[model samples]
Target: MPIPLPSLDDHDFDDLVGEARALLPVLLPEWTDHNPGDPGIVLVELLAWLTEMQLYQVDQLPQSHTLNFLRLLGGPQWSPPDTGGLDAAVRQSVAALHERHRAATADDYEYLVRTTWPEQPQAAGLPRVRRVRCVAGRNLAGTDPAAAAPAHVSVVVLPEPGGTADTHPLPTEALTTALREFLDPRRILTIRHHVVGPEYVDLVVSADLALYEDAVPTDALADARNRLREFYDPFAGGDTRDGWSFGQSVYLSEVYAVLEQSPLVDYIENVRLTRTGTDDGTDADGIALDAHQLVRLTRVDLVGYDSYGRTHPSTWELPA
Candidate 1:
């Protein structure tokens, strides 16, 4: 869509004349003959017409000013047209002004990533951005939270779920490289930006819960398991519904709270999180995540339990 030009002045001739007439009561109270035929009213109308013309010209900034704007933008491809007027040049300059080419703030990087790709359609059909999080001061390649990567900004991207992407939807190498190159010129001189795919820590949440007598054991258990999965969702998962925070640790208390919030579950017990492909359940308070790491659910286990020390399967259970 073409960017709309802002109107410099919206006042027309009648508006300007009416304004002047209204001012007469305050500025020149002695003048009572404020009719259309009055000489003063005619003078007011003439001046209003002249002012309206000037306002129209102001809306179209001088040709020289538009050319200067292009020059300030580093003069990418625009040049003064010999045959046609400077309308094309002016349009290009205004469009450039509206384009977000700055990378000073974290938000700028995220916005640029979302907008930069669609404009330059590639032949390989590169992966589209599903979501992105900008993390400042960390090298995602190493992914060490203790390591200080000064002057570095890592953008973690999750590719849209299509176009030959993996089941986890990571961006292809081509797309990553293209995005980095696209942002190089927009970044600050001293800053270096890295574009990389999101690193997700596969985890399984296993728990045993007690349900109210009126609660359906199977249905309640399934709801409790699903609640845990959605709490760490990549797109709509965080506590604020803005996706999970990168580098934010996951605590057992939070997991317990998620299941505890379920209306059917009366209480929760034995909530454990284990990294996928590992036998050791994390007994720590929470799982630590690096600056670029996000949480992904691999499995969920729920079993029925009672205060009387009885345990049985609720809905399903993963093989031990």
Candidate 2:
């Protein structure tokens, strides 16, 4: 007969904690709890408890830190050994717990950009759009749209080739140089680069900026937008047609951005901007500009992908 695994909700966390507390004194004699609420003290107790559970479950003794204990508990890259010393088993269990927690806490952001400008009927004939995919790494990437950190920001742009324009090749060396120049400590402008391809040019960047709360200022935001405009201006100039232009703007600040049919020049448009502080005055969605009124935008329907991979309208505010 096989034993069924218990669901997380079904596990008795309180009983597990109690059993670990009872064994802690035997394992770590020097450890003391002067203040139970202390963060450090709490962490130590938690580790001690987790280690005890590992020992009980595997019927083994730990030789080192609790990491091995976790690895044995079905963590990534861990497999049950035919036989092992008590220490090895304990270490494995600890490692397994760490891996599980890490994966659960990891965050990911994804956005899709699409063509929103209506297709025009030309006498000479409309240019054929090619679809190409190019992935380039970003440099000096910040967690925010505006790269704020001195050396921690990087971005990767994926260009779709063949729909409206030819794919522009983004070289690694060019990106590194651009990052270096964009991140010049003296300049307020944070430079970000993207590669556009066959039918549409889209810029996608991401960074883990720790100082996100203090970095997003009005000046920084303006500079970031301007730099993006300059980065894509050359491509825009080459593909100028009466009704045909760059797609709508989509920016992800702090987390993600999704824009539809943005003017080639409007890099900061349709931003779902977020700030990391306690100020409620900040808007989650940045200032909205009417695409038709502000930029003579031609509304062409587009398809967008949700986090779950379902397709929907590309418009930011969908019709009721």
Candidate 3:
């Protein structure tokens, strides 16, 4: 809805004349010509008309004038996202008119993180923050059992397209620190913000695959491994290439479906899914990630077979 415009003048001509007449008794009591035809009354009406014209002119001033006034008062200016062939300054003015700087809600916080950085160059290394979940809860970190978890906002960031495995593949410390500083001013002063990665669920697949007689077993295994890796990839996982949604659970049925869809495989048999460690990781059959957690494929180990047939055995330890 559009904001309603206010009238330029507080009083109409008649009211202005009446106000002037009301002051006559105090300032000039001896002058008693109060009739509309009197020269004094005509002068008053002319002055009122000039005052009304001045007020109307003030009201008709361009919005740019108002913006200039605000700039003088130290108000921040907005630069709109570039969309070619359009006037960026005009677009920026429109966007700035609608913008609210406060981060009182989850969506608000997310918007601030995405758009409110002071410098664009510094943000190049910052991970594309995929999802943000805010909650008023206690910390559930098993390692830091006594850690306090005040009202916190957890942000999940998508990793870069290609990065080494050992180091963090997403935003570096500098980027995160910059984000922290950027968001600190906009965020609700009390709530804490945390940039965290998805809880990785390592998969150790012990599958008996029935490959086509013409297909090399090693090649088939590699193909199957690649399929699983793609299916569980953080950036391009799930049914669609888009990154997995936060809290999306991993189901064993989906894994089987991907394996069965492989063109090189005749059939998959004796497939067992097992979690790696017991710290809320993947379990047998599937994983039930929490609202702020997501499943990421950490490792893929194909056991019990070589190019010929099943030769070695692999073991998994279940959490007690």
Candidate 4:
């Protein structure tokens, strides 16, 4: 909806005349007669009529003025036939202006990164941006995660999968360059933005899947592994099933829920989400991820469940 324009002068003729009469005792105390027939009242009404007419003209913007404003927006000329009306055209033009053309806020930077990625000259053969997260006041291009850089903004982006074994995809240097070029022009002059790939915290998860009454052991194991993979998938995995949130910790309970959503598994037990390069993931039940880190499910050990909830290896396989 178009923002309603404020009235320059909201007083009508009657309102102006009433206001002038109300001020008669204060402005001219000696001449206290405010009757309609008084000569002083007649003069005041006449002046009020002229002032109201001037206000009306000032408040009403001409069609040419709207056209000039449209021109100042620097897009194609607005046509009544295409937009249905001037008001709608102005609203759409303003909406587009704020959507991707200007990067005045942290949101604008991230919004532009996704909205303008395919349009960049360098994006000719690059993969689509699957996810984007913006962190203001952090310089992610460097190694220091604790440095305070007030005027800086960092954007972590993940590319769409192109049928690769690498489950976690990173934004290529070309992709980052293209994003920088697209956002640099739209960003505010005082702020600096850095385009970078996502940081992945490698993980090795192991879980026992209890098969349902009709579930095949081999097939169920594969399905269970696949579910776990997609549950932490960079493009479409997380608690909300939309994509994992940045800095989100991986909890053992969430893993259980993701696995249990499948019909092949009756129950899950003894889940271990051990972080790579460490003896155990931050703790026994959770893996702590940095603000810019996402889980890279490098490997998962799937097996049949035992009555005692201990390790039970069965004839299960990951699809080749």
Candidate 5:
């Protein structure tokens, strides 16, 4: 359906007369002479006619005329960016006009991956970005940019955290495809990009917990569990809470300190930390992570042997 056009005049002579009559009671209560023969009434009529003339002139102008006036002031001819507000959209469009869309450096490729693919739910799943690292060409020793390989680039990406069962796997196929498609068009001709995930080292913790007299065993255990999870969590773990930085090492002393922080914890006993997957399971003070690798906490178990010679979950007791 066609929309109705707006009225040319927002206020007319009758509206101005009504406004003046309304203000008279408040502004000049003594002067109640509002007849057409009164001088005040005649002056009001003359002023209203001038105001109506000015409004009609303004209302008669076409939209194109207003735009042309804006053009004279060096304003944009087209609509501004879709930022929901005109002032903000104008600024955004001006900034966007000066922005570069092409990726030329390693940092540019890395920056594009983060800004282009925002962390949100997709057709596959939620895209949680952990880290992005890119390097142009494989030759680290080459100082000359002209001698570098034009068709080769190594890109490593770390994905969001996973459940305890999944063991925090690498970035999924969905994320890899998204990054590739986003950068492919902007990349130089014949440029090849390799997208891969970082390597992870799996770890397991074994510790004995003793509850104090004022501490509840269940509550302490829960806190202990959460502390370990937060310590190893890729999204919100480590000292900084920004997720452990790449190649950061895990120390057994830190784990002991975390568990001991619980008010219920009297003392930790038989505390042992071990690294799996890469070598024989052995006790270690800490696990060393490579530059491209992160540590993943696989399991945390507390147990004791029963009279039946079977191992079962248990918590140590504290004497009064």
Candidate 6:
């Protein structure tokens, strides 16, 4: 008996092609004229069209060559064990197609290079710095006096750098340097640092200071603290906290000192002292604990230097 074929609706196929075009433009901007009227181009386009439709069943191919071409493209998702003899035949056809087209597409070499080159960094200056507390909770330990005590600091900076032209490059560079530092066998603990960019400078830096696991004799901790104090003290002090509070607020202040010294941060702004709390029975004994906190660093209406020298407010919602 002859095999019955699977057919796709014309309108459904068109819709799938349209979706692929829309998605491809954003990621593959150079492939603007992908649908030229050539037999090979048509075959490739049809394969993409089928993929967009989520039609992975191989028996649906209108021609054996179509199945072979898809397999040659390394589309293992479409090739199943049940495909039997069809798989071997497709592979042979695909090998022939490659031999024929290999020389013709050699001229496309330049286009390929241009498309793959990394994007240029966006111009941005240093970022405004702020610090929040890393409160303790279930992740750290059971109820202890220090569990209630704030252990490590949560450094917050703003405006949150999205992969914009300005901030992305700096963070990329900073992340690289940080990873290198982290892998150093001589280094016992991971040192924390912020890579901040200003609206002015196009490049980002490491901001030179490190948050040490233990106090070091060198300038790393001292410089970091001094830089943070200069940026944080003005807004963090005073009515932000009433009467005497556990020196936990000071933890952010110390973190600010580190950021201030960082070469990456251009300046500090909209600095505010916010509180983080936790009810995880394990706290107060200086034992490590995991906790969540609210951060308020930037405000919507304000720009540089508020009435009290606060820069602007940008807040973040972190998971508990």
Off by over 4 Å in 1: 1-99, 142-146, 163-167, 189-192, 276-284, 306-310, 314-320
Give candidate 5's whole-model lDDT. 0.69
Question: Model 6 reaches what TM-score against the true structure?
Answer: 0.15
- Each model's lDDT: 0.79, 0.33, 0.62, 0.79, 0.69, 0.34
In angstroms, give how far residue 35 of model 4 lies from its true place: 22
Instruction: Estimate, for each residue in 34-104, the C-alpha lDDT of model 2 and write its tens digit.
Output: 36796755775687667656655664334543545455456578654557765556555655444312111
Cα lDDT tens digits, model 4, 176-266, are 8888887888888999989988888887778878877666666777787788878887767876788877889898888888888878888
TM-score of each: 0.64, 0.17, 0.62, 0.71, 0.53, 0.15
Error of 6 at 107 (Å): 67
lDDT tens digits, residue span 1-320, model 5: 53675777799998998899899989999999999999999999999989998988876756566445544544566654455554555455556655557788887887777765573234246556667777567422245422566567756687765755554668787777777776788888877876767666777778877666665556667678778878787667888887766678888798888888877676777767677665545446677775556777767776433234344364422111
Pairs that collide, model 5: none
- Candidate 3 residue-wise lDDT, 1-320, digit = tens: 75777776666677788899999999999989999899999999999988877777866757566556545543565333357323454556566667867778767766666566434566765655544444334343334423556676655444453435422244556656766666677777787776544454455555766666577666777788778877766667778966566667777688779888877777766666655575444466677766555565555555434446754333332222
lDDT for predicted candidate 4 compared with the true structure = 0.79
Better of 2 and 3 by TM-score: 3
Which candidate model has the greater TM-score, 2 or 4? 4
Question: For model 1, where is the 10-residue window of minimal lDDT?
Answer: 311-320
